[model samples]
Structures are given as C-alpha cells and as structure tokens.
Target: MIQIGDRLPEQEFTFITEAGKTTATSAELFGGKKVVIFALPGAFTPTCSQAHLPGFVVLADQFRQKGIELFCLSVNDAFVMRAWQQAQNADAITMLADGDGAFSQALGLAKDTGAFGGLRAQRFALVAEDGVVTELQVEAPGKFEVSSAEAMLKRV
Candidate 1:
C-alpha cells in the first residue's frame, strides 16, 4: 500500500467541470500542490454520501485557507461522480472518477468486493505535497473514522 514519503502513481482521472469532461493527470493535480485527497468505495453509498463527502464539502474552505486543495475520488464513472457532486452540492470539492479502479490499484488501495461491487477503492485519505504523500489515513473495513475530513483537519 502507498505510505508516507511515497509519491502518487502517475495516472489519469476523469473529471467533469463547468467547461465539460476532462482528464487530469496525477502530476497535474498534485505536483507542487498541497492536496488532501480522499477515496471511497463507491458514489452514493451510505456513509460516503451522508458523512464522508459532506465533511469535506463543509471543511473545504478551511482546507483552502490552509493552502490545500481538496479532492474526492471514487471507483464510479465520471457521470456518476458528477451527479453525486451535484446532488451533494459539493462544488468546492473536485470529484475524481477512477472509472476502472486503475488509480486505486496503482496506489495498492484497491479492495476486492467480489460480488458486492467487484473492484473498489478502500476508504482512505491522504495529504500530499508536491506529489509525495505526507500523511495517510486508511479506514478499517465497514468502519469510518480516521479518513473523514474532520479527522484529517486535525492532522493536517
């Protein structure tokens, strides 16, 4: 699994913006930027929708005030991610689509859900500077805590 001091893997993520759909490389997003990135198993899931994503949405300004960018990633497609962002009123957070779970796999954070949802990202979050991980918080299965934005805020 990716850990502190490890650089994010090079990968492309699909993003839906006001302009339209676009692809951003990991370098483009994290290089020279202090970023707090969180990943969930899927979009519109219970904890993810009710608490995980909302916590970040509510704390986005604070993170930005601290010179950090916020990103929320999921194993869903770009369309689903876009919809979820809109539904959650999360304009302050950038939604990243790991459509095929490639990026999660690259980070060694991919979880095998079997028939439940196939391959998905484990619930986790990390703080990175200039593409290198500075802090990482991975949640225990079926539980939520350390990876939440509130928890991250205290650490970052």
Candidate 2:
C-alpha cells in the first residue's frame, strides 16, 4: 500500500452529494488545503453505518476548525452515495462515489468484497496537504483501525 510522504493518487472521482453531483479530482480537494479522506468498503453496512461514517460526522466541525476537509469514499453509485449520506445524516462530510473502482485501484487500496459482489474500497485514511500525502492510516479487513476521522484529527 502507498505510505506517508508519497503523493496522494491524483485521480478524479465524482462525488454524489445529497444536494447535487459534481466531479472533483484529488488535486482539487487537497491541492492547497489540508484534507482528511477516508475510504469505506461499502455504504450502509453495519460497521460503516454505526461507526466509520458516524465518527467522521461527529468530528466534522473540529476538522474544519483545523482547516481540514473531511471526505468519505465508497465504490457505489451516485444514487447510493447520496442516499447513504442522507440516511447517515452526514452533512459535514463529502461523500464520493468511486463507481468504476478506478480511483481506488489507482490508490492501490481497492478490495474485493466478495459478498457484495463488487470491487470496493478498503478502510483507509490519508492526511493530505498541497496534493501530497502527509500521513496514511490503513485498517485491516473487518477491523477499523487508524483511519477513523477522530484519529486523523489527533494526528493533525
């Protein structure tokens, strides 16, 4: 997996926001600002629903105060991403949809979620500034590790 000090994968992903939709590149999000981006296996799953997303949601304000943008990424479609954002009440975070798995693959963090029947994102977080990856946190499968938004905030 890619590590700290490595440049974050420069890839474009279409974010499926609840209000609308738009495409953003990695550079666009983190080029000149500090960014906290986490990847999830899939949206609406138990662990993700109750823990992963919620952690970020609750810490959004603190992150913003620290000049960080929080984002959550999944490999689902735009509609699913939007619905998940609404269902999870994640108003403070940007939900990005990696529908084609291209971005995740490019990051070398893509995973095969067998039961979901799809290539999905792993539980990972990257602290990026000025388009460079400053820190990286990767969790084991089925185990949420250093990628929690709170963890990232502490690192900052």
User: Candidate 1: TM-score?
Assistant: 0.98
- Residue 153, candidate 1: C-alpha displacement in angstroms: 0.4
lDDT of 2 by residue, 14-92 (tens): 7655356788888787788888889988898888998999999988999999889988888888788888988988978
**Backbone steric clashes in candidate 1, count:** 0
- Over the full model, what C-alpha lDDT does candidate 2 score relative to the true structure? 0.84
Instruction: Tell me the lDDT of candidate 1.
Output: 0.94
Best by TM-score: 1
lDDT for position 21 in model 2: 73
Q: Which stretches of candidate 2 lie over 4 Å from their true place?
A: 17-19
**Tens digits of per-residue lDDT for model 1 on 1-156?**
998999999998888878898998999999999999999999999999999999999999999999999999899999999999999999999898999999999999999899999999999999999999999999999989999999999988
Runs off by more than 4 Å, candidate 1 = none
lDDT of each: 0.94, 0.84
On lDDT, the candidate that comes out on top is 1
Task: Supply every candidate's count of residue pairs whose N, Cα or C atoms clash at under 3 angstroms.
Answer: 0, 0
